[model samples]
Target: MTPVRLAFCIALALSAAPAFATDEAPPQKATNLGEVDVNARLDEARNSLSPDTGSSQYVMTRQTIQALPLGDSTPLNQVVLQAPGVVQDSYGQLHVRGDHANLQYRIDGVLIPESIGGFGQTLDTRMIDNIKLLTGALPAQYGDRTAAVVDITTRTPKDGVGGSVGITGGQFGTVNPNATLFGKKDDWSFFLTANYLKNDVGIENPTASRTAIHDHTNQVKAFGDVSYLINNDTRISFMFGATNNRFEIPNNPGQTAQFGYLDVTNFDSAQLDERQQEKTRFGVLSLQGKMGDTAYQVSAGERYSSLDFTPDDIGDLMFNGVASDVRRANRATTLQADFATPLGDSHTLRYGVYGEFERATSTNNALVFPADGDGNQTSTTPLNILDSSRILARTYALYLQDEWSIGDKWTVNYGVRADKYNAFKPESQLSPRLGVVYQPVDGTTIHAGYSRYFTPPASESISPTSIAKFVGTTNALPDNGNDTPLAERSSYYDVGISQKLGTQWTVGLDSYRRNVSRIQDEGQFGAAVVYSTFNYDQGKVKGDELTVNYDGGALTAYFNFSYNRSVGKRIITGQYNFAPDDLAYIQDHFIHLDHDQKYTSSGGISYAFPDSTRIGANYLFGSGLRRDGIVPNGDTMPAYFQLNLSVAHDFNLTSVGATHAQFALVNALDRTYQLRDGSGIGVGAPQFGPRRGVFLSLQQDF
Candidate 1:
């Protein structure tokens, strides 16, 4: 059956099923007198403008997420695209403040380690209750990845037995079916959500292709959480999630064969079929309790991910004279513990320790022609080469911080952390963080902070440099021994102020600067668009962000603007990843980073009418993304703008639960824009943004 038809049938079946009755309200238990309850002292403050230490943070609740034109089917990355200082990439990868692949993810205060790179988003936003984007000069508790910290709080068990089923479909032969179930029973509670998606436009289209071929995807995802309350002061919970996805790599048509072999002359690139598959699963067990004046929580988790890429042999060999089938398997395990205590009336001390172990196995099957002295293909009989290896990566970190209050006007937070990593060599560093918040009057806050950051190389992308097999072959490149990417160490400074204009209006401004001895970024290379890690010898970044927000009972709106500049002094490692001329130019002059954009802005207005109807409109604007030119990264794509609109209606059924239907229009203007130019410095393929589309969804809740 077609995806759209299947989704329609599922929605019909759900509509026909009888709605389950809501559970009765639980009886209230009497509280003991003269007893004080203490919970975990995590910096649990939800306010983004609170007088907290360490730079700026943005928090988005479920309501805020739903208010955006991007619906519940959106992934966490799409939601983050609305934030300041974030840039959109062709592969759905996000770059924060000019830094790449440096974001850390946490769920319910437990860390989720990095997995193999693929086209699927591992974390679904439907299961999220709230998300916090912490950036700028980070606190010591935030280590490893330092560009940003994405902390996600999952939806908790509902007060009664309830569930929701929904289906969404739109242009591009898209279909999505999703469901959520949650309930509470005495001391035990559980929540679960599952989603399946099929779409014709799985990945971005080539800028010149205009149309995509062999680009379809089907994905399955599920998430679950269960908790048992041992008592009011102690609790245990288990969480697990899985994602399985398959994609057909899009093709560019009408390409003549670079080499004309016997009996095969016309090489239509569109006929070259390529595919990728990925499977990932993870689980976490956590326990939290309070003992006397101290609070503690501990968590342990393991994750496994595997990716496989298959290439079309005939087309690849005819055009590029090479084909590589690759497979990667990865496993990660983590253990973490946190403790918090109140010291006197002026200080609150918090500390944590974390340890992780990762193992990755990579295998590549490559077929290429035997080359002549001039590096020209000579043989029709393909030469077969096998490359395989396994590596272990380990990390350990410890941190301590104190939130000290001095009178009513000033607050200071200070901490230090140490991290050690074992991969290429034994590498370690110490980081210190400090932040001060001043409140001169009511509804006003000013903050300044500085941080020393140390980021270890990504475990999943690193491998020993092996240049012997392809040295004299068609896939040859000048190879040096120092090919592995290096760690990054930097110093960051930030300042910001937030003020309330009235009861419903607020505005804020923030600025930051970063100086680095080593910078890290990931880039796609080769025909497969395989990602590899590389570094800049030295660099600096500067940016500023402005935000204005207004909330009036039924009306909500926000506007944000950001300006950024990122430059690298020289190429430090993995020269094989770049073209020789571009590398030479970068070595001689300061070069703009590939993901750099001069200006980015986003704005939205949402209103809820009294008639149970809602409307929202939003827009995203960008000056341009960097591209290749006479000099490295000297050109950029044309500026582009996109507008989105959404409308929703909620109907209350007297005998059943409420039902909601929504319609959305994406890229309302249908502006055609390119995300990446094919010839850019370090860009492997060209991609264009989505065109205009109309989408609809229906859901029923009980």
Candidate 2:
């Protein structure tokens, strides 16, 4: 069925289902708490003026996600798109800060994947508690991303023991279920969430010679976080996570012969499969003790992480039913220490020094299948054909920062970091950051800052520079070596102002520009150029954003809008112009160049029922984004409207407190359309997915 038809059916079925009974009582009053303003990851005192994390900061509140617009119970990737500076393309990638592709992704301040590259994929957003975007001057402890930074901190239950399960099923055999098990007690806490989604599809928006094929995906994800207080002055935490996903895509796209006519059944569908798995484990121990007349902190940590991807078949070859296979792994360990001091009453200073050691290995092999003349199945690929090789990459970093007090009305922050990569030879770099803030009155501030960044290329994308014969070789060598390389330098400059109008409203404006000298050929370097694991030259990007928020005890709302432009090129590629304008695998001169969007203009009204039940209705309107250029010359789709509702009630059961039952109807008005496309030709069907869906939750506090 066409995506539009699917949206219509979903709308009809929702109207027929029992609507959540509205509780007409006034909403319960609320107040923001804690110095760790989650949205901005800043102190409340500092938040009073510059409150919105809207531009450089992106947040996905759990309350808002449970009521998302997609048909399947909400996925993490879907929630991420709700944040400004994030864009999704036809192939399910999360592009942030205008695709200079300098995205440094991390968890609790540790370098993941070990290589200079990032692990790219669509995550189930339900598994996350918070998502933070750092467009400029990311903390000193975080390193190696040339463009921007993304940090994810999982949720740890606030109440006693409880859990919730949700399932969404509709057009195209989409079946996705997610569940969470968590609990918190006295001084110790534990949390866990597990999810899986698999669906089949029949191709549409057919190209001239392309045939329809069946496609299915099986994805499973799990996350757990446990923490404990060693004492009033100390705390320790540990985290374990896993992601296993496999996609059995439809038939491959290849000509029957290099110079022959097109054939639809030329490749097999069942023969195509892609498997990816990642596992992470880390521990944090921190002490809040005093070192002198002022306060201080000392923390230590150990971490282990791994990523493996094995693609069994490359093209679903009909001749031998065998294709190429590849594998890669990275592991690391580190010792960290930090200190915080006060330069004065008005100015507080914080600085940290840290070191890390990492080990990594990569392998790639292509099997030769001696198939019969007509392309029939023979024996399985050989095990002895193992052409295995391993290499180790090393690195260490040191950083320091000072949060200075300009006076009772102004503050300044400046810091610098240095890093060295030890492999083949040693390459070193220094990154610097500077920021200034001024508070003119009780709850208002204007800030400006600039920072330099560096990113090394991923291991897979780097080719070895030198190789010598291990054994006797007359045109026959036992092994070939691959050298690792680093991505060039990058930098950013930002300026903004924020102010609290009074007791109920706040607004802010921010602008930034970033440039990277070296990009990966695929993940970090000119990764999109020449299809080699090589590096590309100079690329530039810039953008602007604005945010506003209003809250009055019983009511709260926010809206964020951003504009951006990105350009990628082969400026200094040894006089080679493979595709000067193209950013990566995408067409040149044509980039996700510009963007504009606004959100959360909607409002929520909650009423209390006589039996102690509450109901809420929230209206939402989202602007469309482009993976191609922001303004298409011919036909440009603007924006659309949507409504969502949620209801839940609590009742007394015993002295320990009873349970709460809840349900939500997302995308009250199902609107199906394409969101993004990496291709400039616009040949793809605009990127299709599900429409509206339902969700249910049950929780108990004891």
lDDT string, candidate 2, 83-148, tens digits: 545554333445565652446655544333433222224344655655555554454545665444
* C-alpha-based local distance difference test score of model 1: 0.77
Residues 1-702, candidate 1, lDDT per residue (tens digit)? Answer: 246643432222110000011111111111122344222222131111112374577777788787777568777888887777788888788888888768899887788987787788998889988777778877777899888888888886667788899998998888999999999888788999999999888889874443578889999999999988787677888999999999998887777776544457667898889899989999999887666555677899999988888988778777777677888888999998877666777776778899999998887787877777667877666777887878788999999988787777777889999999887788899999997777667766666778999898887876544667876667665663367778899999777766667777767777777998778877776656567788889988888777777778788787878889988967888887677777778887888888889899887888999998999998888888888788878888888888999998898863558898889999898889888877665687778888898889888887
Model 1 residue 155 CA deviation (Å) reads: 1.0
User: Candidates' lDDT values, in order?
Assistant: 0.77, 0.47
How many steric overlaps are in each model, in order? 0, 26
Residue 40 accuracy (lDDT) in model 1: 24
Each prediction's TM-score versus the true structure: 0.92, 0.69
Worst 10 residues of 1 by lDDT: 15-24
